[model samples]
Target: MQVFEDWNQKVKKTFNATNPEVVLTVSEAGSLLGLTKDQMKLYVDKNKLTKVPIMRSVHRYLLLKSEIDSIVKTR
Candidate 1:
């Protein structure tokens, strides 16, 4: 099985290189991380999270589901 960082790299590359259609919105990402929307936004602003810019003033954060799951498991 792939590690979280490896999976995150794959997803980031897919977004930046292939430009996929199914990127997660901030809200969706927050749900995965067990974080509130505001907290997620804070992480985005701090560059702790990766957000892909899809269109004019529109962006979505990319998060590995496994990474979030790991966080929940550890917590």
Candidate 2:
């Protein structure tokens, strides 16, 4: 029954106020790294970056803002 479905699913995707971590799209992250979107994809693979995959989708993901910041400081 619809009532039995998880109430969490009913929540709005835009409602992420509780989550403290920030995420960035590939293009945004690429800009911060001084690399094109395509190059960033390659860099992610070569560096084994953790990709936050989108639900019901492939070939798309988000990167943690903190992780990118650390990399910038180190590299």
Candidate 3:
């Protein structure tokens, strides 16, 4: 439980540090949304959420902080 709490605090700190132009990793996005990594991928796959490709690899994507905030507002 302590470990989980510590992880959550780290995630929150990371999220708060992000700026509008910044892009987040899958783990970071999942942390902001309170979802697992797999769940975040699922959301992307389903088109319920969107991400930006960081490179030529489709698997390497980044989420915008604005989009995350919009999702949170809707929820």
Best by TM-score: 2
Winning candidate number (lDDT): 2
TM-score of each: 0.45, 0.74, 0.62
TM-score of model number 3:
0.62
lDDT of 3 by residue, 2-75 (tens): 44555434444565466446556777788888999899889867866566654346466667767888887888
lDDT of 1 by residue, 1-75 (tens): 955665444555667566543455566667776778788888667755445553333444465444455556876
Error of 1 at 7 (Å): 27
Tell me which residue pairs clash in candidate 2: none
With a 3 Å backbone cut-off (N, CA, C), the pairs that clash in candidate 1 are: none
Q: What is candidate 3's CA lDDT for residue 27?
A: 76
- lDDT per residue, candidate 2, 1-75, as tens digits? 345643222222332354576677777789999999999999999999988776656777778778899999998
Question: Which residue pairs overlap in candidate 3's backbone?
Answer: none
Candidates in order: C-alpha RMSD to true structure: 10.2, 8.2, 6.3
What TM-score number comes out for model 1?
0.45
Q: Model 2: runs farther than 4 Å from truth?
A: 1-18
